[model samples]
Target: MAPKVTVLDYGAGNVRSAVRALEHVGAEVKLSRDPQDIREADGLLVPGVGAYAAVMDALKASGSLRHLGYRIAGGRATMGICVGHQVFFEAGVEHGVRTEGLGEWPGVVERLPAPVVPHMGWNTVQAPEGSRLFEGIEDERFYFVHSYGVLEWNFDVTQPAMRPPLVTWAEHGAPFIAAVENGSLSATQFHPEKSGDAGAALLKNWMGTF
Candidate 1:
């Protein structure tokens, strides 16, 4: 059976493309904001496109915040994209406005220190060793459209027996997180749904983890 993946529909933007992308990757996709679906699916995809504060408001307004926390705390498989990926951090500061995020990791989302603001278009990422998501597409470029990002990563597993998260990096004017694979949680700063063939292969690789 295909992996049951639920796409969180918290009114971020047009998520039909993400739905189509997941389906193309052989996932049994379901579009919903239901807490039950969020918890029970084999994988949950949190997708977003827009400002950081607005995305958090939508997630809170729809009562997805707690359930998402619950899902992640339980170590279930979850993936975030774009602003969805941004909200995994402790906070995001956009245009002088500071908004709290899910705090899944210790970091702050700030404006990219780049001559070009949005960091739009195709760019290659330096995937860490042992990354399952970039298995076949390690050298390929993926689509990105964002201004704010976690410029630094400070989260660490203090225990000697635990493995550190695999972080992928890409640069505009300075290096920023491109993607992260931390145990049951994974996320990307780019839109796999819009990345054409390379993106499809990435989605396929993620589904393999399910």
Candidate 2:
């Protein structure tokens, strides 16, 4: 069966590009705000741009946030790109605004402490020991354009409820969370859709999970 992927536009820009990338990886893609379609989707992709609070606001207003949480909680595959990935954390603090995230992982999304803001361009990532996300393309670089990221994975590894996500890290001024794989939930701080061939491989690997 062809992979069915849903790309969400929660008031963030550049969705058509994401849809195009997903399509390039041989997945049947749809851009939607309808809760039913999002809930029933084989894979839910939350793509975002702009501030954390703004993305959260649009997600709440879209009425799909609840469905997103429900579907992921039920062990359905879901992917978040860029700010979409940040919103899956506990909270994000941008310009003094504290926005609550989906809280699927233990961490805070805050600004990168780099000499340059908006750490843009292609960079290499330190993939986890055994990650399905970076599966055969570990040496390839990915595109990143963001100022905020979760600097560390903060969770009690001893606790079963606090299942630590398989995390990938990258460096700008310092190391930060790049991608995370938690069971049916996966996210990337970098824009896979914009990262060229390596991005395509990552997307293909993700789709192959279905």
Candidate 3:
């Protein structure tokens, strides 16, 4: 059977393209706000658009936030896209307002240091060696449209038995996280849904992990 994936629909918009893209890659997609479905799907995709604080509020209002936390903490397969990716961090500071995030990792999503706001367009990412997300398309460019990002990475697994996250980088006046492959969780600053063939391959790669 095709991998069963649930795309969290907390009214953040821009989710239809993601749903279409996932289906194009053979995923059985379900767009839902149901918490049980969120926790039990073979893979869970959190797709977000718009401001950081607004996205968080929507997730909370729909009661999907707690279940999202549960799924991630339980080490089930989960992927975040765009603002969905941003909320994985501890906090996000947009328009001088600081909002708490899912805290899946330690870092703050801040405005890019570049003179250009949004940093919209296609760009290549420096995928780390052994990165499964960019496996076959390591040299290809992906779509990106956002102004805020995690400029620095501080999450390091100190335990000798644990593996650290494989981080990818892209620049817009300065370097920022492009994608991350950390255990059961994976995220990309770029939108694979809008990334064309390369994005489909990337999504297919993630599905292969399940």
> lDDT of each structure?
0.93, 0.90, 0.93
Which ranges of candidate 1 are over 4 A from the true structure? 157-161
How many angstroms is residue 37 displaced in model 3 relative to the true structure, after the best TM-score fit? 1.2
Put down candidate 1 lDDT per residue, 58-107, tens digits, no spaces: 99999998999899989999999999999998999999999999887778
In order of appearance, the predictions have TM-scores of 0.96, 0.97, 0.97
Q: Over the stretch 1-210, how does candidate 2's per-residue lDDT look in tens digits? A: 778888875667989999999998888998987777788888989998889999999999878788898899889899999999999999999989898999988899999999998999999999988899899989999999999999978777898676677999999988999999998999999999999999999999988776
Backbone clash total for model 3 is 0
How much is the lDDT of residue 10 in candidate 1? 88
Model 1: residue 46 alpha-carbon error in angstroms = 0.4
Superposition error at 176 for model 1 (Å)? 0.2
How many clashes in candidate 2?
0
lDDT per residue, candidate 3, 98-209, as tens digits?
Answer: 9999887788999999988889999999999999999989999999999999998987678688788999999998999999898999999999999999999999999988
- Tell how far residue 63 is off in model 3, in angstroms: 0.4
- Runs in model 2 lying further than 4 Å from the true structure: 161-163
